[model samples]
Target: MATTHHTNETPTDVASNGTAPTSTVSPETLLDYYRQMVEVRLFEEAATRGFRQGKVGGYLHVYIGQEALARGFLDAFRKGDKTITAYRDHAHVLFQGGDPKATMAELYGKGTGLVKGKGGSMHLFDVENGMWGGYGIVGAHIPLGVGMAYSEAYRETGNIIQLYLGDGAIHNGYFHESANLAGLWGKDGMCPCLFIIENNQYGMGTSVERATANTNLGSKFDSYAIPWEKVDAMDLEAVIAVAHKAVDYVRETGKPYAVEAMTYRLGPHGAADFLEQYRSKDEVREARKRDPIGLLEQRLLDLGVTDEEAMEKIRAHAKELADEAVKFAEESPEPDLSELTTDVYAPETGLI
Candidate 1:
C-alpha cells in the first residue's frame, strides 16, 4: 500500500517519523545500485569536463549529489512506465535505460544524438525507452505529464507516469493546476501519476528556503488531497524502500502519489555557474558527507558485500565507460543541413 500521511502533513513529518518501512533489499541489489551510482558520478564528471572544454553546449546541469533519487526510484519502474522531468535530466534519461553515447552526443549536438541533435542538453527524448524528453522550462512539463497520465488512465493502459520536478516548480501555476486535475482524476482511481519532487535545496541560484514561504514541498500536495511523504534521498536504501511502496501503490490503485526526495545539488546549479555566491562552501562540504555513492559504499562495506579492490575496479570501469561516451560524442557528426525541415511536425497524410 502507498504510505499515507495525516491531513496536511509536512515534509518534516515523514523525514522524522520513518513513515516508509526500512529497506529490505538484498545485498546483490544494493551492490548493483551502487554500481549505477558510480557510473552516474563518472558520467556527470565527464559532462562537467565537456562543458568546461566547450564540447558541450547549452545549460549543463549534472546530477552529482542527487543520483540516488533517480537511481533508487527508477529501480522500481516497470517496462511501460513513463518519466518526465525538468532540465536537470541527464541522470533521469540515463537511469531510464537511455544509451550513454547517444545522450552525450545529444549534449554535443551531434546527428547521432538521442533526438537527432535537434534537442541539446535540456531536451533529451527517447520515447522507445519511456523517457519522454526533459523540458527546459520550469513547471512547463507538469501539465503535459498530467495529460499523459490521464491518457493512460482513459485508455486503461495499466501504466503510470513518474513525473519529476524540482522544488522551485511546486510554487508555479502549472503545478497547482495539474496537481488539481491529478487529484480529481485520482478520486476515481484513474490517474496513476507518481509525483517525485527532486528537492535539491536550490532552484538555480535561489535556495528553497528563500524561494517559498512554506519549505515543505510535499505538504503542498495535501491541498489536492494527494497522499505525500518525504524521504532522505541521500540514502539509496531509504529511497528504494519508499519508492517501491509508492510505485506499487500507484500501480495497484491507479491513483496519484507524491514523494518529496530531500536531496542537495552537490555541484553548482550548472556548469556555467562558476561563482555560487548564494551558498557557502562549508554547506556544500557538509552535504558531501551524505553523498549517496559514499553512503552506499559504506553500507556495502558494512555488509561485506564488496571491498576496496572491487570498488576500485568498479570506478575504473565506470570511468572507461564515461570516456568512451565522450569519445563517441566528440567523433559523431553534426545534424545534416536537410534536418532543418524534418521533425517540425507530424508527416502529412492523405485521406482520399
Candidate 2:
C-alpha cells in the first residue's frame, strides 16, 4: 500500500499557493460574490435551524462554508448550461434558479416541492432550470454528466455540463472508470464536462490524508491526460476566476476538464452525523477564519461598495428569506396516501 501524510505544519493548500489565480474584476463583481456568499451562508444556517425545529425534514446536508464553490461555479456558466452534483445539493439547486419556497417544500416533503413531494432532500430535480437531479448514490452521476456532454455535442448545442463531487467520491472506483471514459471522449473534441472535486478535507469523517494514497487530487487528472487545476474553494474570487477559465477552456476545446476545489464542509457530513470526533475545535475555528463569505464581505468593504451595516443587512435578509421558506414548508400538507400509487408507473391502475 502507498501512503501520503499531511500535518498542521504543512500547508495542505491546493489553491492558496502563491501561484493560484486571483480575481481581477471591478468592484461590482466582488460585491456580487460577497452578496451571494452571504445569502448562501444565511440560507444554510436557516436551513439547519429549520431542520432542528422540525420545519424541514428528511436528511438535510447544509452547504454552510462551501458556498463559494457552488455559487462561483454557477456564476461562471451561462443560463441553460447544465449542472449535476451529489446530495450536498441545496446550494446548487438554489443557485440554478430554484425557488426557495419549492426547495423548502421539498425538504418539508410537501406537494409543492420541486419534486412535487416525490423526492426529499436527497433527490431534487428541476428540469426546467437544467439542474438535472441530485443523486444519492456516491459517484453514480459522474457518467451521467459525461453522457449529457456527449449527447449535447451530438446535437451541436453550445451548452456544457458541470459535474460536482465531494473529495470522498473522488476515491470511489467509479470516479476513475468514468474519468477514463470522459478523457477518451474529450480526445475527440466532443466532451464538454467539467469535473469538480469539492475537497472538504474529510470523506465522511475520514481525513483525505488518512483515506487516500494519492492526496494530490489534481495530479490524478494529470495522469488521465485531462487539463486540470486546483482552486481555493474558500475564496469566491479565486473560485470564480479559476472556474471561468476552466469552463472557457472546455468550451473552446470541446474537451473535458477537472478542478479540485479546496474547501471545508464546516457542517457535519449530514444531519445524522454530529461531526465532532474527527476534527478538533481549534481546527474548525481556524477554518472559519478563512470562511469564503467572510472573506468576500471584507473584500466588499475594502472595495467600498458596501458598508458593514449594509453587509449585515444582506445577511439578515437572506435569513428572512429562509425563515419565510420554513413557514411555507411547515404549513404545507403531506402527500395523500392514495397518490402513493401514482407516478410510480405509466399505467394508472391502482396497486393490488
Candidate 3:
C-alpha cells in the first residue's frame, strides 16, 4: 500500500496517512484525558484482582496500555455518533460514559451490569451512550458497524460511526466485505465511518508479521480506496491530533476513513494467557517505557498543567473510584432465571 505524508499544515488541514501538528489544546482538556487514562488503568488493575479472586467469571481482557487510543479517539466523537468494537471493550465502554459500577457488575455477572449480567466481559452494550455493543467473535461487528453507517446515511442523520477492531480482525473476510461496501457506498458521500485499527503488535500471541504478508495494517484500507493514517498511540496529544483529522475527513466528505493506532498491550492477551509463549517478558518490560498512561502523566507535569501533588491526588481518586465500583458490583444482585427468555424476543403482541 502506498503511504502519503503531509507537512506544513495544522491538524485540521491535514489529510489521511499523515501526522497532524499538535495545537494549543487547553490544560483542562489535557488533564481530563490524563484522568480518564488513570481511571481506566486503575479499573483494569482492579478487574485483574477481581478475576484472580474469582469474582469475575468468563474470560478477562484488560486495556492496561491502550487507554490513550480509546480516550483520544472517543473524545473526537460528536452527538449521535455510534461506536462498535470487538470483545476487548471494557475500556471503550467506560470511556463512552458507561457507569463504572454497572460495568464491573456485568463482569461479576450481576443484574446491575450494563447488559444485566448476560453479556459478561465481552458483550457490553449501552445504547443510550451510542455504544452499540462489543462482539465476542472476531470481525463480527465490522458488518454491523457498516450497517450503522448505512442507516445514518440513509436517514441523512449526518452522524458517523466509529468502528474499532484489532489487528487480528483485519484478516477476517467480513472486514474486507464491510470495507468494500463502505468504499462503494461512500462514493455517494454518505457512508461516514471511521475504521480504527488498534494494532497492539500481537493478535493474541501471533505477531502481525507472522500472520499477514503486509505488516502495514493501514495500507489494507488502500485496497478499498479508503484514506488511511497511522499515529503513535503512546502520545495522547498525537492520537487526539490525528483522530480529529480522521473524524473531520469522514464528516466533511461523508466518506469512510481509517486510522491505525500503533500501540502495545502491556499485559497478556487475556487473564488466562499465562503461558505467553509467543513473546518474552523483556519485550513487555521494554514496551512499558512508552506506557500511554505514564506518558500522559509526565506530559501533564512537564507542561506545568499539573504538579506531582495534583497527579498523586488524581491517582488516589481513580483508585478510590475503582474500589467503589468493586464494592457496588459485589453488592449488586444477580438476574433472576426468569429473565433468560424475557428479552430474547419482542412482546407477543407485536410492534405498537
CA deviation > 4 Å runs, candidate 3:
1-20, 348-352
What is the C-alpha RMSD, rounded to one decimal, of candidate 2?
Answer: 7.9
Residue lDDT tens for model 2, 242-343: 877778777778899999999998888887777479899999999999988778877777778999788778778777887788788889888777667677
Number of clashing residue pairs in every model?
0, 0, 1
lDDT-superior candidate, 1 or 2: 1
- Please list the residue runs of candidate 1 whose C-alpha ends up more than 4 Å from where it truly belongs after superposition: 1-20, 349-352
Clashing residue pairs, candidate 2? none
TM-score for each predicted model, relative to the true structure: 0.93, 0.90, 0.94
Instruction: Note the Cα lDDT for every prediction shown.
Output: 0.86, 0.79, 0.86
lDDT of 3 by residue, 236-327 (tens): 88887777788888887889999999999998899888889999889999999999988888888888989989999989999999999999
Better of 2 and 3 by TM-score: 3
- What local lDDT does model 3 show for residue 195? 96
**Better-scoring candidate (TM-score), 1 or 3:** 3
